[model samples]
Target: MADKSSNASKKSFKNIDDTQSYVHHLVWLDKNIENYTNQQKLNQWHELDDNIKLFSHEEECINYIQKQNDKNTESYIIFIISDSCSEQVIPKIHNCLCILAIFILTTNSENCQILNYPKIRATCLDTSDLFNRIRHCIYRDEASIGFSLLNKQDSTDAEPISLETKSNEQYPIRNLQEDQARFLWFYKCHNFMIELEDDDRQAKEEMISYFRIKYNKDKRILKPIDEFEKESLQDNAKNAIWWYSHNTIMFRSMNEALVSGHISTIYSYRYIIKLLCRQLKTLHKEYKKSISNNRLHLYRGQRLKLSLILLISNHINDLISLNSFVSTTLEEDVAKKFCLGRSKNNDEAVIFEIDIDLNSEQNIPFADIRDVSRYPEEEEILISIGSVFRIISVNFDEEKELYRIHLTLSQHEQLIVNKYIEQTFATEIDSDDQSILFGKLLFDMGEFEFAIKYFENRIRCLSDHNNHYRPTYLNNTGVCYNQIGDKDRALKYYKKASDIYKETKNQRGLGACYHNIASYYYDKGDYDTALRWALKALNERQQYQLEKASTLDLLGCIHLAQRDAEAARNNLQEALRIRVKYLSQLNTNHPDIGISYFNLGKLDSKLSSLIDAQNNYSRAEQIFRHNYPKTHPLITEVTQCLEQIKRQL
Candidate 1:
């Protein structure tokens, strides 16, 4: 039975290629570690000394060790095994570990007949511990004598080493493999290291006691642990318990930081998520392997959960990165707006509930909802306002702290809806304020259909009562409809808005309405009519330099469509100049800036200045990538244009 077990162990590890197998064993050994020295801890030691190597995973450690073995140099290694170590790799690579130990042990053996041991630290020790012990044996005993004893024993017996042998028996050696016996020595050393830590603590305590006695007698050479010294002691004490529930502590800290508005804590949470992503990716590779073997049942559910976590982590990082640009005061204002909905005059509060998705809901609880009148009539009541969520149910789940309401938006819509609730709700609002907000937020979120709905609602409310500001809402609604491809309805609304603007003698309103009309013509490929209206808009917007630049860009597009490169270049350059002047006041990643860059790039492309075109297109791409989701139309458009430029080059 002993011979058979030895033969099986040999067969199991005989085919290992190299040190990679040892990495596999180490990875497997640390699979179920509850606490780890996090990467952040390792980072603190980085650059302190060149001899220290820190690795986040096993493969890197293996490669580093292989290099060190080649140089035959003494160095330190810190390995951070992530949470994904378990249920992924198995311990089938024990042979390489033995081989590596043998290489270390036999170093300089040809000259001195003695072996030297290399220092290795990992999360855990397994069968490889025996190999380490063999190295230690060569160091402890006389080199030549040790070699002779091993050689004589090997020549005298065909039997494998037995772990249970007694000194009086013929084969007194342990009935274990040569490599397995070394584990005993490794266990002894590990226990000794633990004892050293305890001993050091006790020695420090004794020295402090002696100092206190001396201070009591001579009043010198001894001082109490001050507050600073006490803090240092407490920090050192925590090192003992650092691993216990560290992951749980990270999540709790993140939650506290988020609630307390600590930006640094939010950043730390992002880093933690990034690390988890790396761990999950490693586990996912194992899951794929299990699938090919028809053993996916073992990990399919776990894989699904990990994938969900990875997805959420990516989204959260994106949100936090975007929010870093917003001011703290602005964030507070937005929070207040969403937390204080308006109350109705009938003594009933307007309960605003946001349906996040099919599986989840959230109620917006307002602490002090005040009744506000929109129209002059006291009977008219406005319940709620936002571009994102429509009321499905007002029911609140007091017990669960979540509202069980169905969201009417799709997945993408829900994301933008939540974003609007977070970013744009930074000011007090009433029913009349809804029209402007709904148009702006929905337009910004790329929800043109919903934007038009709110704009039309606002227009209807004003037109029904003969409000003089009806034309402005009409023009805004026309822009939204035009964005959604309802060209005929867009034209009708534009004409009505144009007529009303003329009646009111609102030059700015007329210019903006004319630009929309010109935009419609441009989309229809009627460059002549588009150019005519664009020029009219430009002329009226000349006094408003900011608005004038936009009209100039539109004119440039119209000219470019007509194949007039020179005119397009002139108009686009002027627009770019105007945009640059206001760059400091505007969001650096404003969509309009990207559009201007894109238009300039297009004109340069038409002129066959591929280098200039590429540069401009690159600028546009950067802005679009930074400001919008990857799938946004503007980003997609810029990507397509950049690809075309690459082809042209």
Candidate 2:
């Protein structure tokens, strides 16, 4: 076998668990993807090796390589960046796509203005620079830790993220000229580490086996899609509703709400890749069974195992590659190679579970293993979406080198919505729409602080186009603030939204602004002010049948709180009608259905409809418990209320 030690010790390959080589991050690039695409004009990658080095500051390194090396056999790539590019001007991945853009030149230069791409500071990073840096331990090779996207990319207008917990004690910066001889380096290595649990493997095998059987056993041949059974119909929002006085079945439809981002939202289910990974081992057992029965060739099991490995690896590779730039790791490929620095006989790093404390000293031993037996007990074991880092412990090598130590964020927070006022008035689409979407996800995930930053990023991007987007951004900002209990900021934004709306003939915008402002006032116990705004918004929304759900719901709550029993009943009934009709098309088990039911139950209880309230409450409780964690506070509260109500009965 090849001396694994020597090859591994040289280390720093592109596809390692701890380190990634090709991780490209274009911060705030999501905001202006079009600008980058246009500026980079990705059609000239092959012809511009020299130009590529200019942005990465690797011109000197490339020159050094060409001069010193005899034949230049190293088939490595160097990236070139543009000096004028900002986050809005740079593409997110400085990779093959960026390179291919130049060669592909899909659009004519005359039509260039038609495409808007986010851009990055185009520079070059050469293999020579990377190699020498690995030898010397110089961090000049490290990408400058830029401020948050809120700071205008063209100028340094940013609040640098603060590190609440410091990373590990700082080592003295290293000199690049001096070889690895000067630094005490620890080499790393990696191997494919299995993670599939027995039960998980079984489930996967069952799923696949079921599919295979369905595919092969007495197969009804594939039929054309156009030939179908008689179409079925249901009493759904998609269907027409007939209205009558006594036996009226109302079907109110919701406009299909785009989950904001063009990207599909990952929900509680549909984690296909993860699901398959979990069940691979079960198929392994089946593989053995087939082999023993003399019905399977040796290669068959190997093929399946290989497929499983490749599948798992590809998923991980994707995660690493996509997140590499943002995580400040070399792209995933480079990070993967970081593991090769160790021996095959050495401890193989199965995983890397790290909480990067963006600020304070954190001991991120560059290498780790999946020593599940020796794992630390932490509050939450966080394995991110990209790169399932298996910490490979116990690979100590004196000759190993640290190519670069990156300065990156250790923590994340979600920012609550604010500044709906800004959103309403803003005319141009935000350059950082992706970040805004990410922020929304964080909000949905309850990472309020992080969400706030994303929305703020969108808000800042709208500064230039404030006249058009100001209302919506401001409104969103206000909503975020309200969620986080920042009443002052929320009110400020809501008022701004109101002012912006007054400039428009849009009653919908006006109503939304008034309603949220009323909510803020109500939350603060400013009953009179709350009532005035709510009534105003309600009266306006009463004109538009399309968006009456929110208005009615808010009105119902307002009336219920004020003990206006008759008004509350009417509003709640209307809101419930809207909600039920809208939800009818969804699966009965959907969590939102439970929320609507719970709200209806609350209204019923307030009106002393004990049996009706009890039934709705029971439905709500089942859905909530099934969809949410047992420890969820909402679940606990609902359970407690239900018990109390039952005791009253």
Candidate 3:
């Protein structure tokens, strides 16, 4: 039996490479794993880590650990072996670099302890003791918060982005800095959570169903899930903080999903997220009225990787946003103890000293949750997710052997972001629905894949095929496909939207679809077909000035392709006049206006008006450079045109 088990283990771990995505893995090897009927014992094991992988053979487990080492992945493995195979398996996997610790599950732990394997951290005869020891190891090794830094220079240099559909493209160009884009995306998501409306019973049932499927075998978690479902029949929002503070399935799953940025998981857990935020807001209001201090200081301690420490050190004056709900304390010693705890070799202990100004009119909320907390003695202060703070200073505490980072609540960074959001969305795509707004924001940020998924989800939820927003969703999905270079799929969705618009007599939707079709034909070099669609779009869009301008721009491009310089010039100039007059009222540097200037420059060059061409090209270059990255295609093309005109002069 032992030899057969060893052979099965070797063959089973051929696919061990799939576990690379996990930062920490738990591997349990017991020959009787299939026959193990101890539900309570299994529940205790799962509490240590929900994603435990069970194996019935020792050889397979050893191969899995060796494979992890071979890949040199940045992950640690906790290995648990039954007594029957412990002596043989420990000697094989103990030397593997990825193995963090080894546990011997035995009937006689005292006898096993005499083996003296340096990697063996514990010899456990019972599950409770084993759970405690493993929990400590996991916490000590992986105690950190997820955060992203926005350099001060990057934010200061970021110009207002223009969300104009450029010529020969189906969607608008986006060039926001990467960090700024993520920050705004999450901020929008937070707002969406607050505004989302769903039946509490339905949302809670959905959440419970999801976890029940995940932990079908573990009764420890299932019991709480059942209790939560029963308690949710009452006032769930009032107890949201208690559930969040308690180390249960809700707390673990939500935090893990938030830190990993798993969109699907977060959506499944939205009910709890919304509940927690709403409760926190109410508490924040009352807490503000009760406090008399003009300023308050808070501290949080954790171990971070050296790479993250260096990143924070290098960007001292920049902005940082915590990606999850942050827990801090008013007592410095409590926080200090957390940092001073055991940490991995590549980690450094750090304490975050956060200052809050009570007088400032900041939108982000934080509250003392002692009254509603699961552990009130801890005196926890919970800061809402997506909170932005400025890194005031960072210093090393020589005597304490740790680093101290100073952060202060600031809305200056958010103010800059607000301008960009207003300019990008407020003037265009005017929709009050938060879901639509968030989907469009993702599309504008060049997150085509995410945008596609979001639109599809929205479409599925809509019951009416002729719903007012159906055409919009279909058209946006098509545009996302086009951006990703899928022309056939793009055209299919465009035609679907066109059919819906025609049936519903939504003139505006029909006009947008016609413009998209024209753009598609224009890209294919079908000048006559492109002209026909552009004219149809113009007829439908006459009442909408910006939409009319877009159609005229398409007409000018088609005429230019047909070698009618005189006709192209007429159309281009008309388009330019309308765009300048309308867009100046909103943003002077709108990219649609820049697109007009570039098209006119091409027309002037064809007409041999060199000086006129130079002026138009120069204007286009200025706008493109300000609103886009230096390497953007528009900037590159305009720069090349200027160099040619200069040489001719």
Candidate 4:
């Protein structure tokens, strides 16, 4: 089995010789990774690190690990087996980790890519005894929280991230593929809103501890017991009891996080689904015998996992839907809008239901609803439902689980009726948000692995929306493909967008597509072709008075490439002028403006405007020095230009 697994992994890698795969990516392994103290770990990994030949991209690595659920997969094995380690044996892996840590930071929440890799800190050793209790409080399933060693260290040991310091603290979590260092970036921007007195520090810390305990509970897990080789009936009971408590905590934590308005750790959700996987395997393991109803508590774990999964899905709608439950009259009006009624006898046999309670204390009975149509095949529900739901009353009830689904039907405009309501309802669900979000979220997060699907769906949706929306859709599709490094497909979409915009005479859209295509050519070092397209884009932008500053800068770059010193000075100077006029006032603290100024200075020097060029270059150097890292190449470029200009003076 071990050999088969090793070979299976090897089969996933055959292109190690590709130059694109080794863009000088550094792999620093920690030497102090308990049980990983070999001399190779001490030095940069050389010849022996070829075992990890699975993926080239970060997204591929994520998907690869997710597919592996076998009980045999070992963490930190890559540290020993992969060729990434074979590249160099840095005298220290810790030295590498220290430098790498500084670059990992979050700009906003959700879908942003994180840079820090934490393979070891996500520990399998569930040392905190209270973790189970916290898990029960957060999730309705215990097995959702597992324990396993997360020993993916390089030659240098990386530091573990500290847990949150506030009990009521909210963490905006991105997708699970993001390591913990990247995950914490989401919480940086939001101004957390909570009302507490000045002396509430201890209380806030306690609140943070509650979440920390649950959050720290492990994701990937090892087997449940080491002494299982001699397990008896006594051990079964203990395991069942422990798992039940964990499930209970997992349920509560997830639900509270949803309603509390904090971004959630996607790890918790993945952990729950994986718990379902484990439950299936356990059921198969116990299939031959009939132990007790308590053993079925194992299935109970899976059930809890599934429910919380559903709960999270529902929360997006529930949270975004807003407070509308004012009066029954409002519900009637909203229902009237979505009623696509038939004429005369209405022999079409339309079936629907709306459950509205005239009873007092109208809470979120609207949310308890899982579905909205009596028809089993519900495809176009969210749009249809949302169009009408936006006008109605939706509020929480005394029993938090119960919700009212209000429906109404009309025979053309002549006849109408409401039916089947005892204050609770069920309808077959139709989902659309998942499809819409699939491409958008993944693309935004730099996880291009999944964006292709969603972009396709969104394009189809926009095409169906109206003729005017198609250009925007095409442009977005092009951007997604471009980010994923599929320049050919990106150009195809940009061309489509450009064609569509031409038909509509939408100059901005046309210019933007040209700009994208020009940038693509520029990056490929096709100077003449890139310059031609960039000029074309500029002409299009000026024809419509579009935001031409960025386009102008590109045009300037093209002239510089052509070595047209006179034309380059004119274009680059104009581009810098436009940026200075519009950018700061527009509230864009554009650090790239410094680069543009430096470019203009170079053009001036080539045109023999040395003194004027020196000032421009000096300003560019100062701006780049202030806004960007001291080591950034832009600073060096500006410095060299300024120095050369000074020497001429």
Candidate 5:
């Protein structure tokens, strides 16, 4: 007799629990879920994922799945259904994007009679079989990679912008399309992980400690965690790929973090990520030497959501970057099995046909890891994270009933990314420190929370009390806090930074601190205090034209608040003159120039100079629209102001 308790435990769920960070959920839907045997099984399932939700009613389960789908969270569902409820529940939730795979539990497998639903991955009569199938489904879903599409419409030319060229400087590298910016950001993150250095013992201990806390409830995974801790201490880098090949906590956590773009989680797994990349890079060099063919073909098949397929289809000839370390095979048939197994209505079967040129000088690291893999028969070729590939075509194979996306490994996008970073580093961000630059990059990308976390981590790592970069880091944290609307915390960090700058006698740093303090006060409508700080900033920033302009702009805003129109006009005009002269040499459409124009327009509007206000607002609108996204607040605000100006005229 089979144990009904163990069998029921194999069931999975769909809905995500807010408290848990699970990428895969197991949803068990059975009416008799509260029965003694099933209740025991539910306890066992809880070991797998404590967030698992057991629903006795099919409608309740359906509603929960629907709600989760509407949330569009980064998680997938493996649903377990009893034969009685399969017909009622599967139909309603099978089409949900969150549904990864479905398993039907039946007392009699032969008479299951479930419809041929694409999500119906298996029909199991026994506990052991059901358990194995559910595990397999979860692993397969984990193998399904996430990618970002870079449409040609969103792409810029690959030609490197010369800082020396006055014409090129007028269009700064920072003015990148959303897709291009994301691609470069990922590239930079990959590099940061690979190049980051830390005490191996301490990093390993921290990683293991995190794993223990995460998987403490799951008894099955505890042994593997211990084994990894011992094994990693011996030689982690050499066995990195081997460990990753197994369906262990390391692989699961790393993949989940990467796919979701969870920066802090990824940072925690930096030790393992660095190990894997280093091993792959070494194998890549060796594999290159041994290969006789200059060209190679690879394949990876998985079910992609309809939206993703449409994105890829629309962006043919543009670039695509895999978010996680991708696994591909030389055997197309093996690859096809993954996608062709079951396709939910919301997602389509996709087989990626990749062409690689071994002779290309510009290539991201990828290597055949057969010898190093736990499952060597899979003949897996692991591509490093953030590898760029140009989409050749997207075609449907009528007979196979699947879409085939053709891609060629390309270096053009990488070159463009390098140029953008180089230009930004040389001109805008005056920092040689990679950590500071990375934090600044995150800030520029409008990832305020991540930037704050990153800067905080850097601060924690600093041993020198009087480090010159300390004030800058503190100020950067303050800036991020201000952006996120944490006014109190933002002001606290600014004051901390101000104290450091005074002690270091760093004039440039002091100027930035003063300006930020003034801006904070100005935001609070304290014009008197704002003016005092602005004057101090202006004095300290006299040698730095760009910094001086910013201080003047703040002073102008303060004077306007004080109702001193003459003072406001003088300050605003001087600020505008400085901004136009400096910014025109490096992107006249810069957001700073837009700020100046907008402020001047506000002053003009106050004085009842409708014509001057209209002209200033129009210039500000043009610049804001050119620089920011259409949905950006600045664009909407300026558009509203322009409408008001038109009504007044």
Candidate 6:
């Protein structure tokens, strides 16, 4: 037999428990079962009839997981727990979707705590509301962590099901109704995991054998798509939405197949590179056509073409580096499709230095004074940082083992005239005049500590003066503190900035500070305070459409937290309208616009506006489809929402 450690190193399962083909069974234990063996615990809930493996200890289970190195091997987890200890243990193993939690509890009140976990379905020896709630949860499709979608049938429901405890706050569980359908179906077959006193042994074995076959039939048949097939689909793709769905599914299948050591997956990925190259070529042609037709002056058209070219280039680079262990054949085949950073015969070449004078069109030649030698010696030229140059030729030097690059000013295009001036002793500094430019630059670059230092220096330079820049610096410093997770410090800075902005009558600054404060309170679950500040920020930001839209979105969230559906819908819809308008003006869809639509969709779904919700969800899906990869949370979220909506319709 092969060494277990060596086998573990070869396996590459991307998401083990996430695949729907896997089965999840919940096993429960009495809170008093203190020192039972793993087998004893499992035996208390499940019958030992099928091929299911059981381990007594967590370490033994982990080792078992490590040894299942074969790509085709199935993955699953079992949690044997009592009611009291479940909350502590479940969250640790919650990431494994294939795992099932069996809660050994008898009362409906105890079952309420388990409702916070969507994937968990409890079965007691005695009858309880747990079964009925499971049916209701499934019917509503609320098995995921998020707000429950509104259903008219639930009008008489007393209160919104709060997932966490009132006394000790914890993460809320989103109820996914779709999960109910699957779990309910599975449960009806097996009835319960724990063997009952009146249970028939022969019948239990039959049920176990029946479930194993049912699980295998549930697996989705995914196949790797070839380059020609993908190209054909791309050509037929009506819009970005079409491409998004196709690429997402195709890549996911390819990923799964590749991780399993499938040789054909490499060919599919190679085809993806070809497609990217084709896209780049098309963009290049459009750019050239625009230039020839004298239409390059159209900024949007030029920008679009350039953006597409850059996007394609980025995709190509990403694909090439995706797998470090790519076979030699695949690497060589992909390399043949592109020509870059390689030697080409020179039509004409020359070496020259930059002519710094703005009025001069000609460059200066480097001093070459080796007339006695077979070839003239090359002279080194010094230039400041950010100086632009054009390469004419690149010749390899045999003696130095380096490529001697030749360049000239006229051969290549220059995007910008460098304007960087070195900060040195020669440049005089004025201490009294405060400037936040360095601080702002550092903040933009994410150097928060250095940015804080610069902001402090600016404040010191001002000698405690109340200037226009002071509030801006304070507000930005607060933003840095918030990003670095020092909420107390962030709130303090925001308060100071707010005071300064109000004193100076700086509406924009005050609005931003209010928004920051609202965000802080929101994080702390102080919805009332968040709502108050959000309203103020929104009122102040009426003239700033984008910022106003953001504030409106925040207001929508606060309203949702307060369980005021009508107010949430109004705020989210307004945010969506403004975001849509913004994107329309730019003639492009943005991820933020998609998020606005998604928020509106969630609110609409909650109000039982199924058609409106579906429409908004479709639009959000389309936007996310084009802008982000399939794995992006937004894309998956919208996709999942759409699936639930479809079932409802």
Question: Which is the leading candidate under TM-score?
Answer: 3
Please list the C-alpha lDDT of all candidates, in the order they appear: 0.41, 0.36, 0.72, 0.37, 0.73, 0.42
Summarize candidate 5's per-residue lDDT along 1-649 as a digit string, tens digits. 2322232233332231212112678888888766523666766566556688778888889999999888787667778888888877787887787776787878887656647776676788866566655765567654545565544432343332222223422111121233355556656766766775654566788898998898888777877678888774447778999888776767777887776665667778878888888899999999889889999899997876544555466556777777788889998876765664333334567789999988778458999999998667567899988777888877766566677888998774343334444444543324766677778767755668989988887788788764677878999999999988998899999999999889878888899989999999999988889889999999999998878988998898899999999999899889889988876665656667888999999999999998999898888877654444444566678889889999999
Lowest summed lDDT window (length 10), candidate 6: 296-305
Better of 2 and 4 by lDDT: 4
The sequence of per-residue lDDT tens digits that candidate 2 reaches over residues 194-268 is: 121222333234433443454454232111101111112222111111110001101000001011111122211
Q: lDDT score of model 1?
A: 0.41
C-alpha lDDT (0 to 100) for residue 11 of candidate 3: 28
Candidate 4 lDDT over residue span 316-411, tens digit each: 322112111111211322222111111111111111223332232221222211122121111111110011111122222223112222232111
Ranking by TM-score: 3, 5, 1, 2, 4, 6
Angstrom error of the Cα, residue 503, model 4: value is 2.6
For this target, which candidate reaches the highest lDDT against the unseen true structure? Answer: 5
lDDT (C-alpha) at residue 329 in model 6: 12
What lDDT, from 0 to 1, does candidate 5 have?
A: 0.73
User: What lDDT score goes with residue 152 in model 6?
Assistant: 17
- Model 2 vs. true fold: TM: 0.37
TM-score of 6: 0.33
lDDT of 4 at 369: 11
Q: Per-prediction TM-score, please?
A: 0.38, 0.37, 0.68, 0.33, 0.67, 0.33
- CA-only RMSD, every prediction: 31.9, 25.0, 12.0, 27.8, 12.6, 30.2
